[model samples]
Target chain A: MKLLEERIRQEGLILSAAVLKVDSFLNHQVDTQLALEIGREFGRLFADQRITKVLTIEASGIQFAMAAGIALNVPFVYAKKKKAVTLTEQVYSASVHSFTRQETYQVSISQQYLGPDDKVLIVDDFLATGAALIGLVDIVNESGAELAGVGCVIEKSFQEGRGLLEQKGVRVHSLARIASMSPGEIHFVDDPSPAYLVKEML
Target chain B: MKLLEERIRQEGLILSAAVLKVDSFLNHQVDTQLALEIGREFGRLFADQRITKVLTIEASGIQFAMAAGIALNVPFVYAKKKKAVTLTEQVYSASVHSFTRQETYQVSISQQYLGPDDKVLIVDDFLATGAALIGLVDIVNESGAELAGVGCVIEKSFQEGRGLLEQKGVRVHSLARIASMSPGEIHFVDDPSPAYLVKEML
Candidate 1:
């Protein structure tokens, strides 16, 4: 997490109070080594759970989810942003509104890939409005799968994302939790609890 | 490549003469280990190219591009399907027509990530009509970056993807080259020139 925070400070561009652009190394263009390290961090955090699969939305979240899947040695499923011609089966879906794109789109996963037998860990690049992550959680719940937890690489703690997921009793962990940010400065929440980490056995 | 071929034989659903769905393992629900191996295969093939970066389109191509980036120990960039608010700067953009979706969309990458100094290896999950891959190739060319070649996980050789790319004088390598497929039956084109591999001198 320290490394991630440092990288954010060095390379992350703060466009505004609400916008942090990590396109240099996180989402648009990625540092593969850093991504692998982020995955290891997620694996360590959720090591207690018997995670059967990693789930995420398409495009941005795919790399982190794939990295987590490698770390956990499990398959990762990404919900499609659109129902393509080949996706001709019953699906578990949730409608999500994207504040960035200013649109509502349906995210879906085939019923054949997930069900009651699976234990799901949801992962994504950023946690902001919580709209997208919440949609994934709803899909997991609808599939009758057990929700292990949610893991995010960068989190906007000032936003309502963490609060909403915690309200659903979903365990959440973020590598870099931005407390506040402006064009020239940024702050990260150095929470003592690190509540997302599963407690060790006595 | 044999491992990949076997996976397709066992899990791929042949919907028609053209559509072969491997979502259960390749795209939607991804097998992490297999993906890693595929990346290693690509790395081995393109070892001679001094590839500074790997590039692909968003969604389906992220994992494979991530995998290739890992194998090559280089960063990867995925072109955005739409221009989000954060992508406010000047960008290298292309229009790609999706045969399956029956629509054309603009794919763009931040100008900050790519330029003349970088050597890039383009990667993707599938090479069908080569529409998306060609768009990426054009983006790379527009950036003034040197392209090593294009690497695809699966190729429908019966289609014009290879021919189109070849016409551009672009080197193409696919792990599994399918000659044709009909329901339960599939054939592979075993080419003598596996040109991607770097030759060794005694």
Candidate 2:
């Protein structure tokens, strides 16, 4: 997580108080090694849960979900985003409003993938508005699948995403949880393990 | 590749002569171990190229690109699809017509990730019409990057995608090449690695 926070500090581009662009290494352009490490961290965090599958909403969340799936040795299901007004198939669906893109889309997964027999771990690249994550949680609940919780790569903690998920009793783990960020300076959550590790150094 | 071919033979749903859905394993729901094998296969095939990066279009291509990136130990970049008619900022853009979706969308990648110094291996889930892959190829060439080749998980060999890439002097390698398919039956190209492997087993 500290490594992720350092990468955010070094390479993350803060466009505004509410917008951050990690296109250089996280989303559009990806660092495979770093992604793998992030997966391992998620695996370590949720290793005890007996996760059966990893779930995510595409296109940004696919890589991290794939990574988490690899770490946990489980298959991953990426819910497809559709603009259609009607559900054509036997699928669990939820509507998500994107704060950045300024649009609401439907996210759905085939009924064949999840059921009462499955335990799911939801993963994503960012947790900002929490709209999309909440949508995924709703789908998971509707599918009769057990939710293992949510794992995020980077989180803008200032946003209400975490608070909303907590309200749903969703266990959340973000590798880099940003406490606050402005144009030039960014601060991570104070209790990050890196800070504790720093104090141990002689 | 043999493993992939067997998976397709067992699980692939053939909707019509022109459509085959492996969503249960390849795209929608991904088998992590199989995907890693695919990455390894791609890595082995293109290993001699000294690829500096792996490239693919977003959503479906992200997972394969991630896997290939892991196998090659290099970063990967996924182009974003946009509906905008005009270009904004500095980006390499290409217009692609999707036969299935019956719509044309623009695929764009930031100018920062690719350059003349980069050797790129274009990766994708399926090589059907080649519309999207060609768009990616044009983006890579436009950015002054070196094209190592194109790697596809499955190729409808009957389609013209392979021929078009060959005509453009782009090397192509698809793990599973289908010769033909219908509602009841499907057949792979004659020159598949799996058949050759099966000969060795006896």
Q: For this target, which candidate reaches the highest lDDT against the unseen true structure?
A: 1
Candidate 2 off by > 4 Å: A83-89, A191-202, B83-89, B191-202
Question: TM-score of chain B only, all predictions?
Answer: 0.93, 0.91
lDDT of 1 by residue, B21-133 (tens): 88989999999999999999999999999899999998899999999999999999999998877787899999999998889999999898999999999999999999999
Residues A28-110, model 2: lDDT tens digits: 88999999899999999999999999999988899899999999999999999963221234889898997776788888888
Instruction: Write down the TM-score of every candidate.
Output: 0.94, 0.92
DockQ for the candidates, in order: 0.76, 0.51
Taking the candidates one at a time, how many backbone clashes does each contain?
A: 0, 0
TM-score winner: 1
lDDT score at residue B146, model 2, on the 0-100 scale = 95
Could you give the DockQ of candidate 2? 0.51
CA lDDT of each prediction against the hidden true structure: 0.90, 0.86
Q: Write the per-residue lDDT of candidate 1 for residues A84-129, one digit (tens) a residue.
A: 6778789999999999878999999999899999999999999999
- DockQ top scorer: 1
Writing each residue's lDDT as its tens digit, candidate 2 over B37-145 gives: 9999999999999999999998889999999999999999999995222123488899999888888998898888899999999999999899999999999989999
